[model samples]
Target: MRYLSVLLLSLLPLLAQAVEVGERLAPWTLLDQFDQAYSLDDQTRTLLVARGMDGAKLVKEALQDRPKGYLEARHTVFVADIQRMPALIAKMFAIPAMRDYNYRVLLDRDARVATRYAGAEDKVLWLQLDNGRLVAQQEYATAAALREALEKAPH
Candidate 1:
């Protein structure tokens, strides 16, 4: 399958999902909703991927309240280019399920960190934070559909 190879190749460099969770997430700066810069690194205490969907919101809410339950809920990663995902990102964020959880839409900015973190084009990837360390990684596509699939996965 030529397409499959192309797709896998596209995801190669973005696959560095190791030790990023509790391993002091490398400092990354992104502009949040208020048009302000947000940075997360070793000094940070919390990092949330404010997903923009009711279903995802629910998961985030659960994680915030019943962190154990929420973390226990098996979830995977979804990735997409910022250009093709504004609506989906908005929809994913507007859900009451994630009322308190905050997230920044991963953008295709010109920076080495994101470039090394994400990969060619935009990709969806998941990280499993175990006791503050990233122990797992998963990537499906550049959209929410893949995240849905990961939610149902056996993990």
Candidate 2:
């Protein structure tokens, strides 16, 4: 038991080091509101992650009035972690409402992917990548700030 405890303790640091810069992110695929599969690849320049409904709302407001494919054109992808939501609620209310949005929101239903990165629970995490390698990270707590950054981001 002591050996096992020691082994587990040693592994804690590795598990805690989530989403560091200068590291290549493993590729992942998730389905969007439209049930379209999107994958993280070399072409993805920016990844936007929302850990909960609040963060998702911020992204929604920020993208309001934008044309379709606005994020794709800028090589950006938005992911929303919805693992905590009940499946029945998601089907009856949440997902249907999301279909009206102009942007694609990749659903992290199980949180297996979103939990790999570290960020504030109520803030949107913006990860800048270069050919699948992480370069920088930023967190936005407001829609206006996120909108401004998105507008000025390079295509």
Candidate 3:
């Protein structure tokens, strides 16, 4: 019994960070590009969580050529890690440009949301969650590969 307890205790940290394919994501709320509140808990459609600035740019470029209707039809959200940026810089530059994005751009101010999905800050964390549960979590080295992965995901 003591050994079992020790094992369980050792696994606690991993459990906190683990977002397995069949499991539900940790509930989170974030401000969108328009400074409006958005929550993963409210989404009934597939939620896609991408990583940081580069990830966001890659996703934008990859979907740039797709039809507007098709892009609008997808339930995708980009999570940007803006924790390191100065407040003035974000307000002056980032926020305005973010407002122009055609799709929803969620701000992960503290990076807590991004850390819950994946550990890597630089790589694109392509997560597909249904209703709330994660269906797939893929890491891609390139934008084209990321787009291909999304295209092949079960709709």
**Best model number under lDDT:** 2
Cand. 1 Cα-lDDT: 0.39
RMSD of each: 9.6, 3.8, 6.2
- Deviation in angstroms for 79 in model 1? 8.8
Per-candidate clashes, comma-separated: 16, 0, 0
**lDDT leaderboard ranking:** 2, 3, 1
- Of candidate 1, the 10-residue stretch with the lowest lDDT total is 75-84
Tens-place lDDT digits, model 2, residues 1-155? 99999999988645865978999998899999989998899999999999988999899999989999999999999999999999999989999999998899999999878888888889999999999999999999999999999999997
Q: Which candidate would rank higher by lDDT, 2 or 3?
A: 2
lDDT of 3 by residue, 1-155 (tens): 99999999987646766678888777888998788987776353455455566766777776666654443355666677787778899999988887766667778888688767654555677676677888767676677887786676544
Scored by CA lDDT, what does every candidate get? 0.39, 0.93, 0.70
lDDT of 1 by residue, 1-155 (tens): 99999999988755756345345445556653334454443332222232223323333333333333232244322111233235565456532322343433333223334443432232334544443355555543333554354345454
Q: What TM-score, over all chains together, does every model reach?
A: 0.37, 0.89, 0.75
Considering every candidate listed, which one attains the maximal TM-score? 2
